[model samples]
Target chain A: MNGDDLFSGELENVMRWLSTAGIVFALISAGLIAFFLTRRPGWRMTPPAKWLLLVGFFLLPSTTMLLGNVVGFHRVKTSCAECHVMDPWISDLRDPKSTTLAAKHYQNRWINENPCYTCHTGYGLAGNLEAKWSGLRHVWHYYVAGVPEEIKMKRPLPVKTCLHCHAQAASYLKIEQHVDPEMEPQILSGELSCFECHASPHPRKNR
Target chain B: MSDPSPPEAKPAPAEPRRSILALTIACVLALVGLAVTVLHLAWPSPLMFTLFMVVGQGSFAAAMAVYLAVILVDLRRRKVL
Candidate 1:
């Protein structure tokens, strides 16, 4: 199936319902735990009850996370739009005629589904964890501290993300500029930024 | 004169062992869950992701349930229910 089809009506609806149910379950479980803890009964919880509570507590977050991921996948555009700051970038991506690197990539489907996530997420285990943590921080900033007017990446994008696709590709390797033996060290060491030559994928003007 | 006091009962020997065993199982399960989650995040295929979501989270949930059960049983034994 096409990537877009994954977010189509029926699946999206199912994911939304599941997300809502998971949230309700989590809240109820939390409330029960709170009640159990705060109640003025001298009586201790039985072993079975204690185990149930423990399981319930673990399940609350775990289930919620699973559902959250699924739901987030469906609402990627909407969730990103919540900050309003990403409006220009999203619009550019959706624009077929746009010439920006990111726009070209999106329009051509160079990356797999979820173009934003594909580019933004780092490589490997640590990179993935970092991405998830970064996402959480973004949510925290959006909800609690309020996103800054000029949103910027916390750090420079890693060259590895680019290399993950381009390094071995015949088209990329065929380019003379990419094959400069002298430049290889600089590229690997990150002394030279990829964007310097290629230009910013998402141009500042679009923002 | 004060009446003779009753002797304190000895705790059951089996209880601690059971709790320890349950704790060990929980720890193992939690580690497995964590590993699966990390793997899923790294590779990110649909099947792997689904497996991670189910098995990883399920393991944690099961571990917690086991611990809670142990606590409940202990409470019952103490007549604190």
Candidate 2:
């Protein structure tokens, strides 16, 4: 999507506000920790109280980080949908008239909820981490740097993601298009793109 | 110097060495876990991130297990369980 289409005015404002708030909160937390650490002898806290405060100081940021991860993991789709840029894509998935491969997979619940993440994220542990990392980077760019004019995938969508589900599907394997041994090898090796045949994978408008 | 008074009749080692060892291991595991988690946050690569998550969380679990073992030993020693 074009930069403008990638992020709407409302989304931009919300992101700016969130980022500013995050910075403010971080500063406040650091200041409090510093204040506690630099207290004078006469105003010294009791040993237990001092230890408790020190532990809290150390735990605060880590706790915040963990909370963010947990929230992102569970609410990925909602978080992604917050950016209106994805709205059209999500809507297209739900559009009954749309016959794109993506739309069919999404509408049919073949991949379940968060269909965007399901197809986009790599498979297994490494894939999950990569997706999370990419997501964090996306947030950083959207909030810290101005959103780019063109939003592009970091890499071509991996064939592995497609094969993860379809490889084992009896119906998929039985299909004539997938029956050719040469075609299977080529597709598996990434020599061929799935979209080559599925030309209207996400047709912008229904035909 | 007067003969070292028969080594001062070394006092019996009352504190449970096993408990102390377990607690020390727990603390070490916890610190390593924290370090891994911080690394994951700072410079995340896919492999490192996966390793950190597995090892980091595993360390925390191991620490808890060690602590639990200590508790169980203490309870048994005290005849409370």
Candidate 3:
């Protein structure tokens, strides 16, 4: 099913309109800023509407973010057949790298069985809007605070996010066999998350 | 040639009071913006939350640059270079 077919006419229209609006808003905002920079004289607006326009300026981006979240949530929840046909982007997860990364959900079994959301929920959930406290806070910790280089060479394991799912299958992993004898203390104490030995599910290029 | 002053031995630069004032105002705005943003991130404040809900996409850094650019142009016109 094409995306057009997957979504009802109204929903598809709204999605299209939203995506287009986001692009246009981004472009227009960038362009206006550029124009204001090059031209010394500022564009004058009527005093009464100026505040309203400023308010609107801020609202547009936030609205786009919300709309994007809604559409993205919908896209992921749809069936596999709908995914392959409607959104090829979702299907691209079948690629080897994505497959391998996703496989770490289980120790050895590499199967494309679970829908992406089954294990990974609560992302972008319009709540927990703190800097070090949001839903994405865990990711920031993993990338910036949690993983230490010294521990990585000494022992390989997954990060905290990995353990969120792997905790259930802890018995499957022969922990002692996988972890170095030296680092057993940390591993056994739950101090070291799994991503220590296993590579990060999502690795950044530049640290 | 009056010991042709070494290029590196130039007189110390003077601070522009006008520029300083503009910068002070800019810094205040930026701090307020950052505080609101941080609050919005942590525990959302209604006013700040509303502010962020709008204009969240426009880069604050870019806005700062624009604000500074305007001030710089004004300073130049005032022969403060």
Which candidate number maximizes TM-score?
1
On residues A34-108, what C-alpha lDDT tens digit does candidate 2 reach at each position? 554455532332465345334433344345335324432544544565665566677877899888888898778
Candidate 1 segments whose C-alpha is farther than 4 A from its true place: A1-78, A205-207, B1-6, B9-81
- The C-alpha TM-scores of every prediction are 0.57, 0.53, 0.32
TM-score of chain A of each: 0.69, 0.67, 0.33
* Candidate 2 TM-score, true structure as reference: 0.53
Local accuracy of candidate 3 as per-residue lDDT tens digits, A18-37: 55555455445444333332
lDDT of 3 by residue, B1-81 (tens): 577766655432243434334433433444344334444443323323344444442335444664556456656755696
Q: Largest lDDT belongs to which candidate? A: 1
lDDT assessment of candidate 1? 0.65
Please give the TM-score that candidate 1 achieves against the real structure.
Answer: 0.57
Off by over 4 Å in 3: A1-18, A27-45, A49-52, A61-156, A159-162, A170-207, B1-60, B64-81
Sorted on DockQ, best first, the list reads 1, 2, 3
What are the RMSD figures for all models against the true structure? Answer: 10.4, 12.6, 15.9
Give the winner by DockQ: 1
TM-score of chain B of each: 0.80, 0.71, 0.48
- What residue pairs are clashing in model 2? none
Residue A96 deviation, candidate 2, in Å?
A: 1.3
Q: Which one wins by DockQ: 1 or 2?
A: 1
